[model samples]
Target: MDPRQLARSSVPRSLPEARHLRQDDRFLLVTSIMPKNPAAVAHGPMLIGVTINVLLMGVIVMQAYEYFTSYKRRDDRYLKSLVVFVFCANILNTGFAVADVYLALINHFGDVQYLTVSTWLFVTDPVIVGTVACSVQMFFAWRVQVLTGRWYLGLLTASLALGQLICAMLMAWKCHQYPAWADFVKFTDLIIAWMTTTILVDVTITIILVWYLRRHKTGLEGTDQVVDRLIRLTVQTGMLTSVWALLDLVLFLTQPTDASHLIFQIPMVKMYTNSLMSSLNSRPKPKVFSEVTDNIHSIAKFVNHRTTMQDGTMQFASSLHPEAAAHLERHELGEFQKKTIEAASSGCKGDAKTGWDNAARAI
Candidate 1:
C-alpha cells in the first residue's frame, strides 16, 4: 500500500508528459509484437522477385526494339501483332507485381496484418502468365501443324495449352477468394493442376518439335546443319520454361510457408516472350540463300549422275535419289524442303526466299 501510493503520487500530472509516456509505451508494444525477421519469408522474396522481373523487363524491351527494327517488313502482320501483344501483357504483369510489392513493403511498412493478406495485384500474375503462355503455345501448335502436316498432333498440343489456361484462371479466382496468404493451401489442387499442365505442354511441344526436326534432316550437309541448329534451339528454349515451372512448383510444395516460388513465377512470362522473340529474330537471313544454293547444286549433281545407269542408259532409280524418293514414296519431304525444291527448280528467287522464311517458322 505504501509503495503503490508513492508510485501514484510520483506520476506526471502534465498533459505533455503523459503523452510522451504513452508514445513510448506504444513503441515498446510495436517492437514486442513485430517478428524478429519478417523479411526472410514475406518481403524479401517479393523484393528479389520484383528486381529480377524488372531486369527481365529491360531485356524484353531490348528484344522488342530489335525485333521491330530488324523485322519490320520481314515479319508478317500476324507475327508483328503477336509481338506487340506479348510485350504489352508483360508490361502489365510487371506493373502489377511492382505495385503489389510496393503496397505491402513500402506503403504499409511494419503493417504485419497487411503483409499477411493477398491483394488483387497478386491475383493478376497467374492470369497474365497463362495468357502469354497460351498464346506462345498456340503459335507453336500452329507451327507443328504447318511443319508436320498432322492436324491431330497440333490439336492435342492446343488442348493441353487450353487446359492450362483454364486452370490458371481458376487458380486466380480462388486466390482472389482467399486473400489470406495462409489460406493459399486451400487451392493447392488448382496450383498443382496449373503447373502440371504448364510443364506437360512445354515438354510435349519440345518433344513433338524436336522429333519432327530430327526427322526433317535431309542428309545434305547444309540442310541437315540447319535442322541440327533448330533442334538445339528447340531443346534449349522449350526446356528453359519447363524447368523454371518445375522449380516453381517444387518450391511451392516444399516451402508452403514462404513465398520463395515467386522468385521464378515473377519472371516466367518474360521467359516466354523472350523465347518467342529469340525464335523470330533468329530466322535465317538472305545470307543463308548462298548455302541453300550450294545445297541445290549438290543435289542436282547427285540426281544427274546417280540416276544415270551404268550401261549408258538414263534411268531414274528411286534408291539413287533419296530426296525425290522421300517425296514420292514416303511423302515425307517437309513443307520447307518441298518448297525449297519447287522454288529452286522453278528458278524463282522470290519463292526461295519464302521457303527460307518458312524454315524457322516450321520449327
Candidate 2:
C-alpha cells in the first residue's frame, strides 16, 4: 500500500516491449534533453567558457584604462567606440556564461515539468549572440561615420544588424517551438558570425575609401600622415580578428561535436593570444616612450640652437644691439660640455679634414 512499495512493484520494460521501452526511453532521455547538470558545470567545457570570459574582461579593463589615459583628442573617439563594442560584447558573453551556470545548476531538460526549463535557453543564447554580433557591426559603422561623416554606410550597418537580430529571434522561436531544433542553434550562430565578419570588413573598407577620398581632396600632409597610420593599425587588427573568427566559424559549422572541440581549440588559443596582443598594443609605455621622446627633443633643440647661432640665423645685425649677444650666449649652452671642451682643448676632437668644430674652438 505504500507509495515506495507501489513504485518498486511496477513492471519493468523488457527490450522486446516496444511501447513500454518507448516510455522508458522517454523517461531516461532526461540526460539527452538536459542542458547541463551541476556536476556537468565542473567539466572542461564550462571551465573553458569561464576562462574565456574572465580573460576577455581582463582585456576590457586594460583597454578601458588605456582609453582613459589616451590624451590625443582625435584617436579618442575611434578607440573609445571600439572599446565600448568590446566591452558590450564581453558582457554579453559573460551573461551567457551565467545563464549556462544557472542551466547547469537546474539540470536543464526539455521535458521537465516547468516550461521554463528549456525555454530559457531558447530566449537567452540567441539574444546574447545577437547583441554581440550587432554591436560589433555598429562599432564598425561608427568608425565609418567618423571617417566620412556619412549616413548611408551607417544606415546599411543598422539594417544588416536589424536583420541579424530578427534572425536570432527566429532561431530562438523555432527552438522554443520544437525542442529538437539543433539546426536552429547551429544556423543562428553561424549566420550571425558570418554576417558580423562580413559587415565589419565591408564597413572597414568603406571607411578606407572615404579616408582616401578626403585625403586626396585636401593637400593636408599632417592629417594624411595620421590617417595613413590609422589605416595600417586598423587593417592589422582587423586581419587578426577576422582570422580568429574564420577559424571559429569553420570549426563550429563543419565539425561534429566531439571533433569540434579540437578544431575550436585553435580559435580559443587565438582568442587568448589576441587578448594578450591587444593589451600590449593598447597599453601605454609612458615612461619609456616619453623619456625617449624627451631625449630626442633635447638633442634636436641642441642641434638647432647650434645651427642657428653658427649660421647667424639667431644673431644680431650690430654689436650695439644687446639682445644679439644675449641670443648668441643662449646658444652656447651649459657645463655638460666640459668633457667635449676638454677633448677639443686637448686637440683630440674632430679631424680638421672632417671640417667639424670642437666645443673648445666654439667657446
- The CA lDDT of each predicted structure is 0.73, 0.43
The backbone clash count of each candidate, in order, is: 0, 0
- Misplaced by over 4 Å in model 2 are 1-47, 69-89, 102-123, 149-151, 178-228, 256-363
The number of the candidate with the highest lDDT is 1
**Top TM-score model:** 1
Our model 1 lands, by Cα RMSD against the true structure, at 8.7
- Give the per-residue lDDT digits (tens) of candidate 2, residues 1-363: 332232233434542353344444544443444454323323234446556656666766665566556523424455456556656655665566556545644554332233223345324555555555555555555545443446786677667667766765665566566543233354546455544544455445445544544453222343334334444555555556555555555654564332233223222322423432353344324444443233223332333333323332232122111111111211222332443334333432333212113332232
Model 1, position 196: C-alpha lDDT score: 95
For model 2 the local lDDT of residue 363 reads 29
